[model samples]
Target: MRWARAIHHLEALAQECAVMATRPASIFPVRVVELWAVGDVLGPLRDIDAVTVALAVDLPVEEVPWLGQPRGAQQWANATRLDRNPIVGLWRSVHAPVWNHRVERPALVWDAENGVAEKTLAALHDGAGERVRLPAPGAEEWRARLTEELAVSVRALRDCTAAYEQRRWSPGKLEPVADALWRASEGYLDVLDALHGPPEPT
Candidate 1:
């Protein structure tokens, strides 16, 4: 629950910082990826009690202080603490193919790419940590994975909505609904619409 809380906070901060980024050099570029992104799309997650979000950026560590209050607060927290620098360590961890493409706005792209990658990565690893080849994103296996993910999101939304209608609202319980709405905007809607049309008037 702490992890989810932390992620929710970070997401809020990110949205705020992104707004400020309209001014030139107001906020530096920050790439938020991995578990936190996945969590945003399908979370208030289970298992994995201890978790930390990942960020990527190129800047001198000393220049971080110039980033003023709340603009780079999370980054400051991560970099200042000796033990909280996972992103820094990741730079040295191992190599993965770097994606090469024109990003329209590098600072403001959050999409279902993270969700798609999460499914792909899960398919690529067995419970025992053995390697497996993942199905291509448009392939049958990958479609199946996305379908299942959508179903989970839909079910979660329905449950939360029903509970809210019954006046049973609770903090954090509706997070899945939020995730569903967000992921839908992030491209899950197109995927589902292509595969099965709009959800039958739930």
Candidate 2:
């Protein structure tokens, strides 16, 4: 009931209102759609990716990041463990090249004119909660589209939830509907999958 209620709540907010968002010169360069495909939220106050932190926040990868303590500083610290020591000079090589926990290269993906930066992530919203479960039109329609996609997805997942959780259906029993839901959410999930890279061998 809770999950169904949650889905219903999100579905209701599928229509969003727009607000002004300026394209700055070089921070938060990545758009919401890409971030969502990889599973992250949008907006200025939200945290960007770990790689974004290293570059935008100007934290050296070698430093003992604050570690995912609770706040941004702590999450930054968690990027480096016993592994990386990025080379400061060209022809780059680290004291321990493997120490790098950073994935994005700001130098490459940044659109300085627009203030967008590079990042790696999953397709989710940072502000995601019962209230934000519904999607709305944000800076780009992608968020709106994702909201719709999520709405449809939640409904689909609900079916499986019913059969698996409530109906107590077996594999074959839920196969048809499960396959349909998977097909529906596949496009959106692909976006998240891209940020993560290829799926592991099954």
TM-score of each: 0.26, 0.22
Best by lDDT: 1
What's the lDDT for all of these models? 0.33, 0.27
What is candidate 1's lDDT per residue for 1-202, written digit by digit as tens? 3444443443443443344334334343343222222222223234334323333333332221111112343453453351342221111000211110110011211222332233323422222112222112446645564465455445544544564555446555765445434433434354457556677785
Candidate 2, superposed: residue stretches over 4 Å from native = 1-139, 167-173, 184-188, 191-202
| Whole-structure CA lDDT of model 2 | 0.27
Give the worst 10-residue stretch by lDDT in candidate 1. 97-106
Model 1 alpha-carbon miss at residue 26, Å = 32
> Per-residue lDDT of 1-202 in model 2, one digit per residue for the tens?
1333322222221111001113331532221111111112222224333212122222222221111111132222232220132111111111212112122111211222332222211112223232322233244454443343344344545544564554345544765445444543553354334334657899
Alpha-carbon error at 90 in model 2, in Å?
Answer: 48
Residue pairs with colliding backbones in model 1 are: none
Highest TM-score scorer: 1
Model 1 CA deviation exceeding 4 Å by range: 1-135, 168-191, 198-202
